[model samples]
Target: MAPKTIIQQESLLQYQCELGEGSLWDAVRQRLYFVDILGCKIFTYEPSTGKHGYQSFDRNVTALALLEDNTGLLAALQDGLAFISFDQLPFPPTNSPSTYKRLNVDITHLEGFNRFNEACVDPSGKRWIVGTMMHEQGFPGSAGGGLYSISKSGDGLTAELLLDQLTVSNGMGWTKYNKTMYFTDSLRKEIGKYDYDIDTGAVSNKVIFSNVDDEELGVPDGMCQDDQYGIWSARWGSGKVIRFTPQGEIDLIVHLPQALNVTSCIFGGPNLDELYVTSAREGTTAEQIKRHPSNGDLFVVKGLGFRGKERTRFQGSFLA
Candidate 1:
């Protein structure tokens, strides 16, 4: 189960990304950050200075976290979570958070396209993001969707409300003693297991970590986790990428090419086993986008063990 490695390069921004969740790994500039939510853009890849950076935003940023004083936490295109810079946020991919913080998502379900999808940064740095709907209209937990925990101290604290009506509030994991918090809602293919408290951030008991097959792997958006507690899901339309464990067991299967839909994967370079993948032709069917012409590019292979820990968010306690 190892034959999905394509970074061959060639793009229309990898074919107008319909959804290319977060593929993070910016361990302080080692470089690799992503999001193409409808091509609103915010991508940076520095595979050792092959240097590729682009930032264009007005909303559709999806996710971007790094603020242990690194400053750059913008997840907006709708439901608010801003602290951007590049000079003040029209598309400031770098410096511009001298002071800017807007956290606006707690909608309780009207679901007229409330957005914000796929996020990470937990392990006491809090910023476990999720608020999803509007993939053509959705509303999962009734709150239009759930999952929000922002408290590194930016002032807007509403942490822990982890499941709802559901369209796609995807892939997240933390259990190397981070106390356990695994999540995914790829149209409810189901993948959940929570029992975290991290001194009161709260995420109590929610077991059901694997109930997939989304028309044959095209329903579990994004995910990453495997140091020993495996769970790697990305089967958008069955381009395939699966691995599950912790007694819900369904061990391995990684095969992407002609990418059915694939979107999200992380296990960075420099010993993270390097498994970075993100793909999508957003609602494909130009003959499945010409039978998968790298359906939204970017892929890598060499992941077997597990290699994470480069996530940052909780940035609030004023550097507490």
Candidate 2:
């Protein structure tokens, strides 16, 4: 058996977001874009220049995907998906809710749930796979939240429901070859894999990819797949991110004692070899908060010597 490697984490940013999630790396801009779900903010950080800024919103901005042309962003807001632009990023960030134009996509049929929790792009880049969560007080997946998808066609954008029973639809990822899809339902404490169709963006044959049901490991949250087909999952309340192989074995474990409410993670940095993690201080206790003052800060894990797959941009032009 190959010796297990313990990955060490370092603090990347000190800005503690209440419920930080959705870590997306904009390769063209050499920046990382993430959201503070409860803080109702969108943040962008440039690792090389150490430049950081954020824009606040009236509703929670749970997740975001880069537009194909790089002209704007598609954000999963509390009410619905909206289009946003970063053309004004060089200036100080703003707290203007009017900055986003809501997309026509509707989820009123789901009733009661107000926001999406995580999102990912299909291999063709023409479709978006997004999952939802109940913003109000309740257990994670108890709000009847589900998985849905939206695709851009020559006519316009269309929305469709895939899975309808979920509480916290969190981390999402796909294999580099686009042959498999992995989704995380934090409340369920399991990662589900589906046989994916690249041409049609259809997913079927769902199976349990990994189960993190153990209390000591915490709940499974946001996740990203490495180049080697290893899935890296952030364990909420455990302060650790674990790598699981296709054979269902724990390949690696990266820990950040400074934060136990790790919310999400993504592979970024100039080389795409760095793993950036975002955490939360939302439900942390006073004593725990005092001990790990960096509880909600961002972290980075490096030196494992592996790169991640290139991120696919959303091909929709809704902003235009």
Candidate 3:
């Protein structure tokens, strides 16, 4: 086997989070957005000005995507989905009460311990694919969660179940042409590729694309695709961001020395050349925390000679 390409990463911010998971880059706003699922916070950072801000929520804000109109954000909260207007938020973001327009998705059945996890808008921008996972410890053995696709239904939104009995539905992404979809089941340590129907938002023909069998390499978490068709996956317990070729072969790995639970990553920057990563400090013992002081901080990997295409924004209307 050929020598693996290695890349080094640096911490982007000093503000640590308990479980930083979702990483998104708003190309139009030129800002990076991420979430601390356990912290119930959504964070925004502007690379040009070095401005960082975050807004706290009463429940877990698992994932989010920009609206097509650029009016605001569509977030996956603990129990359901909500639309949040950017203009209504404080510039520097605070714990102040903000308004939320909840979508019509009844997830009460999965309440209690299960919460929404990773989410991504389809290439058509008309549908959003999201997953749910049990959040409690020792819950991996229970596969009570599922995956759903949310889209516009009349004047409101509707969620349709696509897959069931999922233990931990984590990362999700699409191939350049939208002909294939990639999904991660963390506990299973496998990334599955499926036949994607962009026009109808249908997924089928599931096949294992990459399986991480090494215990030390960790499981796959959140992921994003580059312009060159490479999938960049964050390894949860290994503190690494790995790039997998379209053929599901590992070609590059970015190491984060200050972090252990690497959660998610996205491509951002003025030219979309930088990869922004998120890590978690949750479940870490005091000794582990002492060893990896920046375990929960956001990180960036630059000069990778890779670029990411602009992410599709949610096209569904929020007006009721």
RMSD in angstroms between candidate 1 and the native structure over all alpha carbons: 17.9
At residue 293, what lDDT does model 2 achieve? 77
The reply for model 1, stretches above 4 Å from the true place, is: 1-20, 23-41, 44-63, 66-71, 74-84, 88-118, 121-182, 185-190, 195-199, 202-206, 223-234, 237-259, 264-290, 297-320
lDDT score at residue 320, model 1, on the 0-100 scale: 22
Sorted by TM-score (best first), the order is: 3, 2, 1
Q: 1 or 3, which is superior by TM-score?
A: 3
The digit string of per-residue lDDT tens for model 3 on 1-320 reads 54265555458796789999889898888888899898888888999888898888878889988888888889998788889888655667776866678877644444324778888888899888988886665365557667888888776777778877676888888887789999998888999999998888888999999997875567899999899989898998888888999888888888887888999999999999998999999978898878788899999888888998778898865644
Instruction: Tell me the TM-score of each prediction against the true structure.
Output: 0.32, 0.92, 0.94
- Candidate 1 lDDT over 1-320, as tens digits, reads 44333332333234346677678776655667777877767677776646565565655677766666665555545566666542443322454323445664343543544677777777777555555554444443343555666543345545455555556677887777878788887666787888887777677778887776547656787787757756788778877677766666665667765566888887777777777778867788888878777787777766355555455454553222
Q: Which structure among the candidates has the greatest lDDT? A: 3
Better of 1 and 2 by TM-score: 2
**RMSD each, Å:** 17.9, 2.3, 2.0
Candidate 3 TM-score versus the reference: 0.94
Measured by C-alpha RMSD in angstroms, how accurate is candidate 2? 2.3
Per-residue lDDT of model 2, residues 75-175, tens digit only: 88776778887763443465544477777764443654756778888778888888877556645434667788788756456777877667788888887
